[model samples]
Target: MLSLLLVALLAGSGAIGVAAANDAEREDKPGGAATSQGPRNRSAFSNPSGNLSFARQLDFKLGDGVFRKLWVAAPSSTRSSDGLGPLFNARACQACHLKDGRGRPPGPEEQPSSLLFALARPDGSPDPVYGKQLQTFAIQGFAAEASVQISHKPRVITLADGLRVTLQQPQYELRELAYGPIDPTTTLSPRIAPPMIGVGLLELIPEADILARADPDDKDGDGIRGRAHMVASPTNNGRQMLGRFGWKANTASIADQSATAFLNDMGLSTPLFRDGFGDCTAAQSACRAAPDGADDDGMEVPQKLFDLTVFYARNLAVPAREGIGAPAVRRGQKLFSDIGCAACHVPRQVTGASEELPELANQVIWPYTDLLLHDMGDELADPGTPGDSRDGRLWRTPPLWGLGLTRRVNDHDFLLHDGRADGVLQAILWHGGEAAKARDRVIALRKVDRDALLAFLESL
Candidate 1:
């Protein structure tokens, strides 16, 4: 808890900045911690004042060897299984996730909805928002490559004084058709890759608290009840555990998260994800002829590769909080707690014991999330593959550190689970399902009050 609180203050270059403002695309929500707007963007601040050096000591900082391994732009291959992906996104983990820690939208100007989560139905049809992440280049005779970039549509909406805020929706488009049409029915959806700091801390939280935060039965009668989403914890072997990572809380651990990313992002296979090959539906022919991860004999490549990649993701540092000493940001911090954002986005959490990283053991931390799933409302729904109950309208509340530098890190600034907004503000605007009331309350605030809210978010 102490480490987390200190991280909130601006210490030095090691620390990150506090806040910034948003444009019209964020009209639905407010701006940063400091602004010409309302309430001085002040909010109450709560942080743990533990020894910073001690916390860092416990951190599993990735070594140069592992970090270097990840930056290769090519995956490692074993004797039997060659680094695969006749059908994949990029050659290495850092391709789309650049710098190993940030996600940005792709448009002339960064907008929400930029980071993309790619997937196809069992038969290879494009999901609505995500046209087709279909792989273009396979092995030698494989397909060309799936198109992955964003396109935009311009729009004009005039305000009361005839001040027109022209904006672009920031849409993703696939180019250079490779093989056949996507199955008319494949469900497609894109989500930004979240930063890796504090994730290990999140993974260590006792599931009891996570599940305890849920009210799946809505017994609270707040119409905003949230519940836990259960998924397989890669660390738990075949055992299923409380889902924690990913937009939909679909993945269970850093390793599972890495495995999914390697296979889907690069078409590489690991022991956990033995097959990099995808099932080709009738509509997509290239997929039919694709190369798969072959374990012909032993499994050395996948084993070592997954281990290092997992280390890289698991050890990344949570950006240090810089410039948090500003008076306005502090005020905005108070307002943040006054509002219920802290309810679902629960502020302080302590990690369970850990053998791998002693620094991770029993130390309290501030992750600002309940690690539960909430229904969010129709305004934000992508209907992205709708079988899971809590998740169809829900998303795990992503951590808020390092946001000020998302652009610097990932080179873009699209927020939200599915990249629905141009900035953090739009992500707030899209909060409608169980959060409709909270959103409406935020929208009703006067101009200054709204700016204050936005400030608080930027401070995150």
Candidate 2:
């Protein structure tokens, strides 16, 4: 009768599809069994995998202490945690990545802390005054590079159903410059800190698998050409390695990324970047002459401490999907693939044998990113010059595994590189180049269908 017809329509529309995805995941993939799942809690995104051994768990605790520990200015009593800044952004990693969650652009009357600015010239050289990053904080007696100011302009997009969503385009202003006026042609990129979950799992994704998914030349003619970023690896004597971290995919591994953050964000040198005077170019004479935190090991962040912090970063677990059993989410999951979003946001990935952490190996995890660079076109591109030497139009595919918990964990709902789009839908509307067709499909969706897709995303 009427009930039977309803069931048939529901089945046709993928009402029961999510069970299949979940059922397949029942293979008991150790790390794949999503680590954090429950009602919202402060520690939701800050748990170690329950599968770790007692000794390994202690190691995670050690790394957590280092990760959250605040660095003091050099010549302090605490020699191990000294060497904060001649010029820097935040004192601790937790300051930027609050609660191991995403960072947003500053709100009204708030100074930028979790966010940092990148300064580069048109010829791919660092600015003479600002160097590479603009640091807004400094130790005693030293002037910070600049003060950051942000304001938003609203760009409203009306959907097919007459629903209007206002997206905020961020305007960055640099004031109280310590050195001099910036070059007229200098390009500025403001980066909001991304979530820290599942970084180790993403790192463990086999290089071969990443390469297999790359279609740099668009040989398949799908208009989705994802290319791996090649960057000089500091760990490998500057040999070329696939860039897997950062907005531009410019960082090779978790170790390199952590070291870069320590040096650039906190002005604390690590074993990789051994200079005690962080990102200070020769022009900044005061910064060059500043005291360092180097102890008996001759490095600010000693090798063992550096490795412990990297381990902490590598093992943070991805939160489990919340509403996978919901019919609306199932439909949206199916629709996500049908609309070609999966071409770039490749959902399922298996980790290879991990030489560093074996607990992260062979898990059928869903990170929802190819970790490849895609051309997002000019709208999202940084004005003037490329952020790195890479194309101005390109950005690395950010993972979507912990996205649903973003607002819950971070208390704000900003998305994208600079936290421009207010939420996920605006982020989708901002997509272009390789993802244009997918964006078009989302724009053209019925209100119910769009709701379903958003439901699916929220379930993630």
Candidate 3:
């Protein structure tokens, strides 16, 4: 029996339907057979997929080594680990994605390691001197691009029940400019490294299934228009494919994402990005002239090593949902649908066939995202880049699996692209544009109902 209020809420928000209250009492494993049954602690996100075969486990371990391997300056005795950076953010993939979980913005006076700045012009061009990303670290002979400082301004919102929740709005500034002043019009978008859970399964989701959910014109008048981000596939010879990864859905594959990070974050050239200087612009001549770590193949990271890192990233398992049978969590699940959050934060998706990794094939999983681009409104928008007209306003809906383990795995619960929101509640509060109607519903909920909603989210 549905409550009249719940039914009206669903109808108004265009939600198809939600499971019965008691249905959640059944054990719900969000990641299908790939879900990790690891202990609920700091190591929760570091486990391999539960269904991975014994032989494949060795490959996962080998990949883990490459992920945590540290790189140093060129001409070092450790030939394989050289080519760190002329200007880079971190020495290793593990440095930014600490403990294989989400990264946090640095506190005042702390130099950013996980949090880095992206520099670009209105036309999506890199800053002439600083290039694409602002690197705060450099090798001995080269100067780091610049240091960054962050400050917070508190903004308080009063809920319908008159409870006040204060959110910290972050302000960023660049200091110690070694490459001279950057272009005045360059947009500085701060990005925090996201978690590495259930990405393999996400990569395996059928493109047709995701495209079927897109309603770009909002012809149904649901006020929720999700559009797919079409990107040129690097492996497919410039063929346009659905962009599945990254904050703006700008990247199409995990392998591509890993290669980009290797170049930009560690200044290590891979087979995909053969630039020895990484993001160093031609304007920085000293960086271009610096010694490189290229091996016989003329790439810092050889193909074999690169493949291992990608495997590690692709196989990080999503942890099983906790506290699902609780009454409050069940109530919250219904409210999540009733309030329209489920419209975009889609609760379930089935991965298509994967010949490469058969364990991930044809499995029902719960990642809680449509993997579509939505206009998130001005509050969350970065500066517009000409490359994509919707660059500023649109963002990919990030998967919500393993979100509840943030504090345990990473010691922080910062959410959103820039890590401004402190917790799930604040993240929801910051939603706008296509999500504004749903955000309003959450704000107007009774305190008990609100608590349940949060409970359901935490259980995911």
User: Could you say which candidate leads in lDDT?
Assistant: 3
At residue 174, give the lDDT of candidate 1: 55
Candidate 1: residue 307 lDDT (0-100): 69
How high is the lDDT of residue 422 in model 1? 68
Residues 271-328 of candidate 2: C-alpha lDDT, one tens digit per residue: 8998888889888988989999987867889998999999888878876655576789
Candidate 3 segments whose C-alpha is farther than 4 A from its true place: 1-27
TM-score ranking from best to worst?
Answer: 3, 2, 1
For residues 97-140, what per-residue lDDT tens digits would candidate 3 score against the true structure? 98999999987768898987777897788899998888999999
TM-score of decoy 2: 0.92
Per-candidate Cα lDDT values, in order, are 0.53, 0.81, 0.85
Q: Write the per-residue lDDT of candidate 1 for residues 1-460, one digit (tens) a residue.
A: 7654554342211121231121112211111111112121111111111222434423323322433332211233443335555555555554455565555554464322225445555443444432335443455555654556666566554433344444455455655656545445554566666665566667778788677778988887877577787776656685877888877787788888777666665555567755545323335445544545445532323565556556545544454454454566655555565555666766556567777745455644556678777887755555454324323567777777556556555556667765546676556656777777666566555656656766756655
Q: Give the TM-score of candidate 1.
A: 0.73
Q: At residue 284, what lDDT does model 1 achieve?
A: 48
Give candidate 3's whole-model lDDT.
0.85
Better of 1 and 2 by TM-score: 2
**In TM-score terms, which candidate is top?**
3
Candidate 3 backbone collisions, by pair: none
Better of 2 and 3 by TM-score: 3
